[model samples]
Target chain A: MIIQTEALRREFLVGTRLRRRRVTAVEDVTLTVARGEAVGFLGPNGAGKSTTIKMLTGVLVPTSGRARVCGLDPVRERRELARRIGVVFGQRSQLWWDLPLVESFDLHGAIHRVPAARYRERLDECVELLDMGGFLRTPVRQLSLGQRMRGEVTAALLHSPELLVLDEPTIGLDLTSKERLRSFLSEVNARGDVTLLLTTHDLPDVERLCRRVVVIDQGRVLVDDELAVLRQQFAGHRTLVVELMEPAPPLLGLTGVVDVTVEAQGLRQRLEFAPGATTAAELIAAVARHVELRDVSVFEPSIEDLVRTIYLR
Target chain B: MLAPYPQLMVAGYRRYASYRQATLAGLATNVVFGLLRAAVLAAVVTQRGTVAGYDLPASITYVWLGQGLITVVMLWGDQELARRVRTGDVVIDLGRPWDLQAAMLATDLGRAGHAVALRLLPPAAFGALLFPFRWPERPTTWVLFAASVGLAVVVSFGIRFLLNASAFWLLDVRGVIAVWGVVGGVLSGLVLPLAWFPAWAQAVLRWTPFPALFQSPIDVFTERGDAVGVLATQLVWAVLLLLAGRTVLARGAGRLVVQGG
Candidate 1:
């Protein structure tokens, strides 16, 4: 396994009372990722996602459990783990703020003991892939937010580590920057065996990059499955919005339609149905036979809906 | 293998460059303190023709040297090791296939180098222009001065490393580091010359590493001690302090416990 955690737990001592109140930030988080697997960690705030990533990446020592990255213990063999993995914490930066991107790369290369030749090759590849053609000389502090994030990703990959742990790499990005980064990640993933473990709140990121997602809430894993399977489990049916030609009569009780919410126009209504219980034909027939139909459209539950279901669950 | 000391050194320098403004501020603070000390020493020397082996010129040099070296040696706010330990950055550091202490020492060396060039040299030169000269008469004294200054950096860095590791136990470390600074100030000869101290005071301060700091540098500048004596004393303190710091580092690492993020 590229990454593995066994009954991982982390407790914190908080407040000023000098009381040892054990608050478990992560509890029994047993997980595994194979080489070349890109697993998305989905969780709400305070759900211990960052905590788990910290322990797994050797940023934090497990309080009462064990974690291993590439078969090295984070606590006992931290340096070795550091060599094999690269990490990016979205909130805090690890770059040299006042230096140009190239200088930061030099420091990273030294830290990882990368050979001069390899450093050049990696630098070239990163610059091309990240489209950092014009900004290599710009100091990190002066770069735009998107530009800086790209530089950060390049720095994290300087050593060509086997695993990459990104905690919300796409946070606070505009639509254009987000799409650019997403494509860059996809290309990088396709070209290497680097196992990626991402923790994020962006559902589109999951949809674009990760096929498997592990949902966490209250410091526990609520669901871990393929994104498709998750949608299948929670999103049993889709809402069918059919516009009526004119003002239609209200149907109080209808089969297959779990709910019928009315629009202000009084001519159109939203119809929700269970996946297997209702067919599009039946709903349309019911609507058409009862009222004049101006237009018809069928909508599947969006990835947003499935994620919301996961969070609600 | 020393593992390409230049690379490590460059990395350290660039890291300080990242905190350039803060480093400059720290250097400025050192220079200000140096000016105050120079004024104080000048005032004292007016009363006595010479205190210790140093005349008024030598005393002024000592003040400037102390200020310049503070930036180079990082005696102030060097709780970095402790912060890394407390914040879990040390975990990543320890997980690397490198010596923990060596990595930190390398970074500090880089930062110290920057401080010396940018902070120390300017004040020292400015002080030299403003004050009279009290330089070493012999080449041997010059050699000893260099050795003593280098050893002083090592000793001071070792102590700061050990004290900084206390963040493993204490949440608020500024108070503890502040106390350490005060104690070091009293002993390190940054405040007063060891030679001018009463015989009893010299006897006490001589036994500690404080003389190795300001006194040894001043002694070399004023050609007070022989080459052999200066080298021996500085080396002794460097070795002893390094051993103590390493022992403390090992113990502190064992007690490293990281909280949840």
Candidate 2:
């Protein structure tokens, strides 16, 4: 495995000086990611997702158990481990705010002690891949948020770290920028030299990028499984909207239908049912027993809804 | 072993130069205060020819040199570390391979280098034109003065590093820093020369490290002090404070780990 954590846990002290309280931010998380794999870490706010990433990157140490990134202990060998991983915190930037983007890249290269020739080649690659050639010379403070995030991504990759960890990378971007970032990340993951661990609240990002996911809540793992299997097990609901040719009596006795609501003076009706309990053909045939249909559309439960159900459970 | 200090230092120097307008405003403020101080010293000298072995020229030199060292040693408003810590941006810094204290020290050294060339020299040169400024009689005093000023930077950085490191525990260090500013100003002799204090008070002040920050450097510049003794005091304080600051930093890092920062 390229990454491994065994019963890793972290707790923080909170509250006033007069009354201290202990809150466990991460607890008993044992996970592993193989080389060249893409995984999504999913959680709601205050769910220990960020804390776990912090530990893996050596920003925060686990209170007990053990964590090793690229086979190196994250705390004791952090300096050596830093050279092997790239990290991006979406809410903050590591680039020099007042300096030109290229200057920030040059400084990072120097900090990592990248050879000049390799640095130039990698810089060129990032600039081309991220489409950053137009504003390479602009100071970071002047760029739009999307532009600055691109610059930050380029900065993290200048040294060719083997593992890339991103926390909320698409949190506040617009649709177009989010799509761009997702595609960019997919391409990077395609290179087969870097492992990617992305933590996000954005479901499309997970559906588009990850085949596996680990979901945690309140410092404990809730679900860890293949995305396809998770969808099959938890994302089983399908919505059916039917437009009838004429007003008819309500269809209330259909098997497998969980919900039914009338609309447009009973000319249109919507029904939600479990996909595995009954097929769409059976539902249409059962509905035909009462009223003739003009149009019918089936909507599968989106990844967002599936995750929300898991969280609420 | 990446040893990113050279690049960090150079980058810090560039950042210092980039704030041209602020630098100019800072220089103007120091010069204005320098003139005000020189006028007061001149009045004191007219009433009493010498106070604490300081003649009119030596007093004026002390005032100007004190003003010059203000920025050179970063006498006030070093809240970058505290701000980073409060905002949790410091995690990015900690994630880097280099030691945080050493890297910050290198960066501050670069800023001091720029201050000497731009902020400190211009005010001293202008002060010389307006007032009777004293020159060292012994050529070696210049070398010793330079050494003392360099040590002053280390001492000042060490103190500020501790002040900012308080953020790890306090979470908000503005109050601590504000208190340090008011007390450090008088104790380090930025407001008035330490020689102006009474003999009994100077005896007590000698026990603290504040004099090594500004008073000793200015005294060496005016050639009214023993060079070896002043420089030794600064060297000792510099070492002590640096070790203490490093201890604070290590403890703070451990706290951050415990607190899940």
Candidate 3:
């Protein structure tokens, strides 16, 4: 395995003088990711995703248990392991704020001891792939958020590390910027040379890039499954809305329908049902039998909805 | 192999040198302080003719040299490491392959180099024209003074590194820095020469690392003490502080709390 952990755990001492408590940020997080696989680590706030990443990256030593990245102990052989991995924390920039974007790239190359020729070749690839040529000479602090993020990614990859760990890489990006970055990541992953570990709240990022996801909450892994399976199992709820020509009758007590509600003085009604238990045709016919439907719409559970369902459960 | 050391230094030099306005403001302040200090010392020397072997010209030289070395020694508000620790940027720093203490030392060297050119030399040159500056008579004094100043940077880096590492445990480090500034200023001879102190106080300060930071270097520049002995003391303190700083850093890393997400 390129990444492996066994019974990994971390605890923090929190609170004030009179009362202090030991809070376990991550507990028994035994996980493994093979080379060249992109996995999404999903969680709600305070779910310990960042804590795990910190241990793997050697930023925080694990309070207990073991973690090995690229076959090196993260704490004991941190510097050696650093040469084999690249990390980008989305909330912070690794670039020199006062220097041009290219200068940061060159410095990263030097820090990692990349050969001069390889440095140039890899840098050229990153500049082209990220479309950063226009602002290569601009200082990092002056770039737009999207522009700076692209620069950050390029800097991380200049050393051609085997694994790339990104935590919320698209957190504050606009829609167009998000699309651009998503495409760039897709292109990078297509090479199948770098293992990708991404932790994010953006559902679309998981849908497009990750085939498998590990969901955690309250410092424990709740689900670890393929994205398709997750959608099938937890994303079973569907919504149906209807506008009637006149006052509507109750559409409740229908087979497979979980809940129903009337609105606008009976002019409209909303029905919720399990997609797996009832076909849209069967539900629509049941509603038609009860009310004169002027218009109708059906909504499938989105990735966001699925995640919310899982969290609520 | 000195991997990535030069790269970090170059980055630091570029970073500090890019702030043109701050450099100009700092130089102005140093020059002003140099003038006020020279006038005060000149008055004292005129009254006593000599105090602790410092005559009018020698006292004026010492004051200007202290102003010039103010930025070189970097005795205050080096909160960059503390800020980084508080903001979680230290995680990014630790994830790098380079040794943290060595990288920090290299960066300080770069900042000191820029300070020598823009902050130190200009004030001293201007003070020479305005005051009775006593130029060093021997070339060996100049060489030894340079050595002493370099060692002083190393010693200062060690102290700053230890202070900055306290951020691992203490979230708010401003108070620590304030206390360090006051104590370091008085004890390092930045406020005044150790020679001006009582005999016992001078002897005690000489044995501590603080005097090696400001007093020993200034003494070498003024030829007040034996050059070889002073320079040797500085070298010893530099090595000792280097070891002490490294030990603190390693211990701090074990308990590091990168404060923010």
**Top model number, TM-score:** 3
Score chain A of model 1 by TM-score against the reference chain A.
0.86
lDDT (10s digit) by residue, model 1, range B116-148: 688778888888887885666677776676677
The sequence of per-residue lDDT tens digits that candidate 2 reaches over residues B1-261 is: 224787777777877898899999999999999889889988998799988788988888888888999999998999998888888988888877777888899889888988998988999999888788798889999899999999999999999999999998888998999899898989988887888888898899998889988998898888876889999999999999999998998888877842323
Off by over 4 Å in 3: A238-300, B1-3
Q: Over 4 Å off in model 1, which ranges?
A: A242-255, A261-269, A278-298, A302-304, B1-5, B14-36, B79-97, B127-130, B243-260
* Residues A1-313 of candidate 2: C-alpha lDDT, one tens digit per residue: 9999999999987888899999999988999999998999999898999999988988787889898899998887877888888888899888988788888898888888889889999999888878999999898889998988888788888889999998888878898888888898899989888899999989899988898999999888899999988887888588888999998766687999998889988998989898888988899988987888999999878998889888988
> Model 2: residues >4 Å from true position, as ranges?
A239-299, B1-3, B257-261
TM-score of each candidate structure, all chains considered together: 0.86, 0.90, 0.91
Scored by lDDT, model 3 comes in at 0.87
Q: Which of candidates 1 and 2 is the stronger one according to TM-score?
A: 2
- Across A1-313, the per-residue lDDT of candidate 3 in tens digits comes to 8999999999998899789999999987989999988899999989999999999998898999999999999999999989999998899888989988888887888889999988889889877877888999998889999999998888778888899999999999998888888888877877998888999999899887888899999888888899988887998678898889998666779999898888988888888898788888898898888778899999878999889888989
Each prediction's interface RMSD? 4.2, 3.5, 2.6
Looking at model 3, residue B203 earns an lDDT score of 81
Clashing pairs in 1: A78-B95, A78-B96, A79-B94, A79-B95, A79-B96, A80-B95, A244-A294, A245-A294
Docking category of candidate 3: medium
